[model samples]
Target: MTDFEYLEPEDTRAWVLHPELLNTPAPARRNAGNALEEAVALAAALPGLDVIGSEVVRVRDPRPGKLFGTGKSEELARSFKENEIELVLIDGPLTPVQQRNLEKDWKVKILDRTALILEIFSDRARTKEGVLQVEMAALSYQRTRLVRAWTHLERQRGGLGFVGGPGETQIEADRRAIDEAIVRIRRQLDKVVRTRELHRASRKKVPFPIVALVGYTNAGKSTLFNRVTGAKVMAKDMLFATLDPTMRSIELPDGPKIILSDTVGFISALPTELVAAFRATLEEVLSADLILHVRDISHPESADQAQDVRDILESLGVNEATPQIEVWNKIDQVDPEHRAQVISSAERAETVHAISAVTGEGIDALLATVTGMLSDPVHEDQFTLGFDQGRKRAWLFDEGLVVREDQTEAGFDLTVRWTDRQRRSFERL
Candidate 1:
């Protein structure tokens, strides 16, 4: 089998490893440990793989050729041999040369954070766009790391060997191939983006105001969206469960229609490459008329996670001034008294919607608030439309809150509440 397609033996064990500098400050080391643990847990959840163990090693001196010093590298080699580890998973992005050197020295397959996460996403992606994005990210990541199994060669005379060595390096060939793949992927993604733009344009004319659900990974945004819209989007307790955005129509209490979109959850330090690759998916959040920022209020890092979501949104050039409803979700999991205290301390009375998505708690109030935002009056006009103009009536039912509709002998006499733009359209009709 080709190297890319070859699977590790079933009996092989995978080790999630992280390296820290020995002289690093205690607080920094502690954070590294936490990050390593998080990465390990995520790695362990990948299907068709067995995680034998995980560890953090302190390298006394950083070696340019390898991440660890000579002695530390020797020690790691011994540990790998003792554990019979078939794969070494690093907790950070590694350059192609570094990956090749590490695999050769450790005598095991090496995968850095980007590659491992890409592998898991490849397994979990369900939609066509999702699959394409994952493949594109993976190809972009692997293009640099395509080196031969080993790079050890005897020193040779100065003439042909010196000239041949630099030109024929496996790393260079891999990088060139990766560039080609990236070009192809970008062209394909352009098509996908154009198709998505068409859909978005159609949605704009549909007259339903869009409400996009967004938050940190595993923050219950999907759960809330599914509850409100009755969509069967995947709502697992894992990072990036819903990579592709999904939208469904929901009827409000006042009979007006609104579109609720469930988008890929945000995360702290999300890989830039993945973000660029999933631009088509994220455009949903960018164009949303309103954003619901869901939060797992019970999590210790909830505040930091919320900040991260804001940062990502800002980076995407999405207007922070756009309407946002801060939905403190998963409140049922917290102590009732604590939840009450949190709600009391929160200052944003109008913009905050505290509720537990898993339960039918406070959801009605939140939906009512969203519907009010959609149907709120920006303009008022009187229009007379013929009964045959069903499109105008339907637009009123969908985007505007109809106050009165009466059948007249000449035509249908209707009183519609809508924006000035809609009022103009009605006048033309």
Candidate 2:
């Protein structure tokens, strides 16, 4: 949680490398080029870093002390020096020893995928809970990397200290300090979580179904959310743009009112520390009455991205019985040839819809589908209740289930349209 700021005109020159392990199982490996591109994009998301170059380094055998072999490491060092690279971002997990050794050999700061992501979350987090979660995740990540100066831990700006500031005196951070910080953060987080739970309980009593939007990073969940709810959420084309859960109530056209939630986007190989830290933030997804699995249908690895979201959702323990609709978003970005095919495929699926959240294409049908799914069956019925049952009449009126009420000589005659669940509740009353 360092608060150090980068001086002007001294942006950190960075290089991104994705180590493509030859020994990795074919099914377990991602497209190295795509992975490198994603890493570059991730780097771009952070400020004060100029990503000058990136590549997929094919590694037959990874060195223990240094992730890359001696010759390869030396060659990369020379290239980094030639390019005036001040930071090296490895698009994979790196042990503390490996990271320290790489920084020593290359004469640059080294940040693995997990650290980079933690930094981004630290930067993007706006809410108190989000900031605390990122801090806890960073502490957990840094606890293992105590081999280097934990300057990032001392900054007030909440950065992980991977970018600049080279000549500061190295302060050896102890395990006890980080452990104490973790404990303190947990206490604060528990309070925040309790407050959030109180708010959630209040929301539950509002008689609106909660519909949550979930997707991979930059998959346009926020855009879709803003389009539907008309709320000015920060819908940026960046990784983890929406870090905290944002909810708004909106009445669908000719449909029931629902609480719509936009949640943090999922990514491939999400850091374990982050998953644990942000579980509370993801509780909104778990309690959702319905989930919209948004996808960037125009991306080349859209299917892979969707699977990653699903894997994260499953890990978060979302109920399998909960309904889900596949939202194939960003159709406007897809090519004409594939756009037709994508729309056709979605048309055949009962739970899939293809639309451009920006262009308003196919949104009406999607809303109609959501309405049909959330709308419960209703039937008209008449009932007579005496004045002694004033509480029951009041309850019926409060539920908006009463259509007409007529005063009778004995008491009242009521005509109501309600679902089976409402009728059962009335009978219980």
Candidate 3:
């Protein structure tokens, strides 16, 4: 079965299709190539899957009736018959009419890019809000594709012989029901947003800085998040493994407390419908005090993926305003020479850190640097506590990173620069 609880044919074969357009900036090289790679990766990631073959087609003039030319369609039909391919996975969004027409030609199940992403999200989402947001996005995406996608939905109606309780075709009924569900989900999502806003406001009152982790899918953001916060979040090699935003308190070497949030990873060619639906979730990134742009240094397309992430951030209008820290992750996977080049290049950026999340290398430096970046300029105060006074010493340890220590005759005299929260917590102690 697919991730969305959709039953899959055991003896099914899938042929991946891509439409090429030379006029646009995203031609076959950029769009089709990247999308096809991801589609094949997704197919491999699925629990149970069978792939007969994959092909890329370039249609000079995309027909309104069918996405492919007549000749190509006939070729594909013949190929499917010969190979017994039972499904077609299109890398681009398909209009309802185009989808219906294309399916008729192939006589098999067809899935579009949006549906595939939704199915992945349905499987990855863990929290209640996460599930609701995914469902909301899927519903919104489905609303438009209903005509071509959901022809299987049917409702039985028999009231007073002929004209009865609901005098409408099953399609119309399903559309109305889905519309109502969308409305309800939006209201629920509004509530979720308000609740999140309240939590954010509360954190603002506490004065702990909020740092959000964001990057392209499988960029090691979740792994870095786990490393920094000591939270056991699910960090896998697959795409879109972490959906919901998770926040945790982490202590810096200097004893400053910060709230670190791991957010949904961005992807190239993310559906516009989903972006609109998940606006509330993206708000967390916008409200962050610091944004960590994590990059999987080992990926072949890491730089392009970083650019894609920046483009999405720009579209969200949070790119310019948010203070950013560039985290080059997965140094463990990089070769020595390449890793040296990356590290040397990264040193030019003002707020860049290189680390390996798997090995915990350079993490302490990352945390210490973050604490230093967040240091308040208003004050410089230090206090000494005796080691014999365990409570006082422990209080000092929690409040600040020790800068200088003296093992005096009286006790352990320590000098520390405290974070804002550490100062407050220290006073209470």
Say which candidate scores most in lDDT.
2
Per-residue lDDT of candidate 2, residues 101-168 (tens digit)? 77778878888999999989989999999999999999998777665544433443233444444323
- Give the candidate order by descending TM-score: 2, 3, 1
lDDT of 3 at 194: 91
Worst 10 residues of 1 by lDDT: 153-162
Q: What are the models' TM-scores?
A: 0.76, 0.83, 0.77
Local distance difference test values of all predictions, in order? 0.74, 0.87, 0.75
Range of the 10 consecutive residues with the lowest summed lDDT in candidate 2: 164-173
**CA displacement after TM-score superposition, residue 244 of candidate 2 (Å):** 2.0
> What TM-score would you give candidate 3 relative to the actual structure?
0.77
Pairwise lDDT winner, candidates 2 and 3? 2
lDDT of 3 by residue, 1-429 (tens): 656776655855777776665555653256566657777766654544577777678777778878788999999999988988877788777887787777777887777878778777887777778788888888777667555334332221111122223433645665777789889988988888899889875775676877789999888989888877778998999888788888898877875688888888888789887788777888877766678899988878888889989988888878464568888999899999899898887777778888898999878777777777677554456665665578867646553567778787877777777655355435534
* Candidate 1, 351-400: lDDT as tens digits: 78788788968898898888776665675555677768888678676664
- In candidate 1, clashing pairs total 0
Model 3 weakest 10-residue run by lDDT: 153-162
TM-score of 2: 0.83
Q: Cα deviation of 53 in candidate 3 (Å)?
A: 2.7
Which residue ranges in model 3 land beyond 4 Å of their true spot? 1-12, 26-32, 146-172, 379-429
